[model samples]
Target: MKTRSCFILMGRAVLALALSFCPLITVQAVAAETASASALENSVVKVFSTLRGPDPYKPWSKAGPQEVTGSGVVIDGHRILTNAHVVGYASQVQIQANGAGDKIPATVLAISRGMDLALLKIDDDSFFDSHKPVPRANVLPDVRDAVLAYGYPTGGTSLSITKGIVSRIEFVRYNYPVSGLRIQIDAAINPGNSGGPVIAGDKMIGLAFAGALNMQNIGYIIPNEEIDLFLRDEASGTPHGKPAMFDTIQTLENPALRTFLKLGKNVEGAVVLAPFSKEADYPLKELDVITHIGDFPIDNQGMVKLNANSRVRFQYRVQQLAKNGLLPLTVVRNGASMKVSLPVSSSHPMLIPSLAGNYPSYFIFGPMVFSRATSEFMNVPNGNPQILYGMAFAGNPLMTRRGDKPDAQREELVVIASPFFPHKLMNGYSTRFFSVLYSVNGVPVRSLAHLVTLLRDQTDDLLTFRFEQRDAEAIVVPRKEMLAATESILTDNGIRSEASPDMLKIWNEKTPAGK
Candidate 1:
């Protein structure tokens, strides 16, 4: 979707006509409206941030600095509330008051990248003395309720206010966090308007964040309920990334399937296809039908009512729980009804991680570069489809488990990142770049660190590296010759270090116990 950028320019002809018809308007009513708008404007401020993000392809390097501008509102606890994307990688932040010329320094105090919310603290306490925090509304505004969007959009140095109405409130996917539950409004959400407050009278109802690319005047806002959750999570002082259900569920809308599952007449629920986590205590099982999540009764479409007027996906109910809490679920398994307590926590680990935090992890031994498979890696051109499929289905218990060994379940996938230049040591070897590793010297590689340990602990004369594809032959290398060529390879390639800094740290910590 296209991000809204640049301020909207108003036509001079429309302005002239409005001025010409000004005599028809009541002076008292206009005065009261202006006064109310001015009061709300005081809480809004412009945010400027300088960011430097890491390069995904070259894990050892960092990208150039980038400058971004957005808007924020003063919230409770003397903090400024804005979008996480605005200050996520910010090295420096400055806040400009609505009508002030001076820009005060600020620091990010708490951030939730998943929720796209961040809280900032002003360096000087005096800023709060003049600007008051806007109170959040406890209840969501009704559809078509009049609202105002306050921010410093593009092309304007001063605060700009736009009048609009709440067009819709539903569970729409939020682009940043890749989650759902958003508010749609017709007010324009230009680039500079991000993080600004959506005001309904005196209370703040939402935060302007994203806009639709294919449609006009379609902007999105983070609803007050989600903002409340973000603030509460920060107040807890513990990082709980994001709460997840950890199960793949499907709607039980098919009457035939529902009947085959023995669901009672008029019963509504969703069927669990698989639980992502392999933990023994995981509550849900395949084919189990979830009838209720907490007090909300799920319908055949896998939706639950938020109130009498609104219903959203059942996952929303799970998102409301605090970390490490229990989500009570009512399920029907094999025609028997039972209550199950599912643990509420962040996403479980997979062979390939969905989100690679700031930098990816990698280790380079001679010309062979080994790195953990991640979503970023899969996006590279000419990636192996088989490896991608394995990563995608890594959550399946049967697929992840290797052979009959109890410890054969791999937690992560390590792959050959790229093809190394022709070398005497690797002669006659046809490398399969991006291929998943099978084992080294007959021992399974569970993680990237495990591979390091396996190589370090090897006592054989030659190392045997196997790939996942059966047709691919093993790569055999003489230990002594390979070790002698490592330094030459590094020097020829002008690599400052053999491995990334994080890998060096892991190697140091994993050094043999008494060595």
Candidate 2:
């Protein structure tokens, strides 16, 4: 009897509470919302940095300093998290919270240029006294969910919140060769918004990193799941990058392809167009059909179910389930089902590698300068499309072989980094500023070190410089005169060292030429 009366009383209370809604209730609700907004705003910060980008055109020095600003947010460790590009090559970095007058000195603790994320450490613990970490959601944000992005964009000094809805979510590429989960939103993400938090209700779904300025209603954020992986990896002394498979793959969408594979109607997945390697022992084989990653069944489109209504590329699971540089996959070879443990890696060498926050390595040989071919080198000519197209017309290796993989014949591509200095040694030589050095004295130039070694121990009467591409002009110079002229070239050009540190070490080594 007492329990029944208690239930009746609770029902009456609920009715009374519903009837009590009035101006007082409205005032309290507004006040609660105001407080919530204040908390999120307090966590947003404006980051200032003075950065110096690499000068590939002049490998001896870096570019001039430039002031840059971006947004960041406070995370679990009381540290400021922002995009790597904002603070890259930064000589000084500071942070100012929303409404705060003074900026606090901060240091970059770690950075992942591939992921475009960076962690900043502030010595002053007082900065966190008023700022609190925004809670992060572990799952991907649902499409069309209302989102609020907080950042300090240009044309404003205060924290700005732009409203939008989640547009799309997918595993996408960030920097070259590095990919992660990215969420697209219709939010007007602008300059200076990078690293700002994208909040869905009370939890943060991601950080703004990119925006399509030419297109409307398009912006992208690095999801919290990727951020969590970066943080965990940073916690370890050595951050083994995200485990991934880089081999070529093809969709199993064509009916003819299915028939060619002799696959049953029940079987579906992606087909391996080609293996990443030629070794007979390589686990993956050309024409192999991958049906599953771990236990998740991959569809004919090379996609897997991420949630009840979400499907993403099967490679997404590799970032999640890869362990100890290995990933498990179910493969059907010659229509026979088998389990395969495939090797995965966070990164691999490229023929022309990115600078990745480091300066370019270079060596000076008399009037000519040589450096490894880099992505930055290619970008320098980007400002002038004529030069790039001309190189393309000439079939320059930097353009023709940019995508080629490093092999036994060549570990690195050494290119002429700069124009020749004014000297008699190159009086008649044609200007081939960016040509790939093929050989010296008919010996194949494998790397910058090999080129330096070949040049250092040269005792020939005449040195012939051959380039990699066909129809390239070759130059012949007097060996002894060029060698003796290098010292004067260094003094005449105001160059402190003839080579970079690594090349200098190689040049100074007394080892025999082949050794």
Best by lDDT: 2
Query: What C-alpha RMSD separates each model from the true structure?
Result: 10.9, 3.6
- Pick out the ten consecutive residues of candidate 2 with the lowest summed lDDT: 506-515
lDDT of 2 by residue, 1-515 (tens): 99999999999999888878776789999999899889999999999999989888789778999999999999988788999999999999999988889999999999999999999999988778889998899888899999998899988899989999998889878898888888999998998999999999889999999899699889999999999999999999999878888888999999999999999999999999988876898899999999999999999999999777678899999988888888999999998999999999987788999998999889887788999999999886767889888788888888888888898899989999999888888887787788999999899999999999998888778889999776678989987777678799899878888888999999889743432
TM-score of each: 0.80, 0.93
Can you list the residue pairs that collide in candidate 1?
none
Estimate the overall C-alpha local distance difference test score of candidate 2. Answer: 0.90
Off by over 4 Å in 2: 1-26, 381-389, 511-515
Which 10 successive residues of model 1 have the least lDDT summed? 1-10
Off by over 4 Å in 1: 1-32, 99-102, 152-158, 172-180, 276-282, 320-324, 354-356, 381-408, 418-433, 459-461, 469-496, 509-515
Candidate 1 on 387-408: residue-level lDDT in tens?
Answer: 5465445432223432222235
The residue pairs that clash in candidate 2, if any, are none
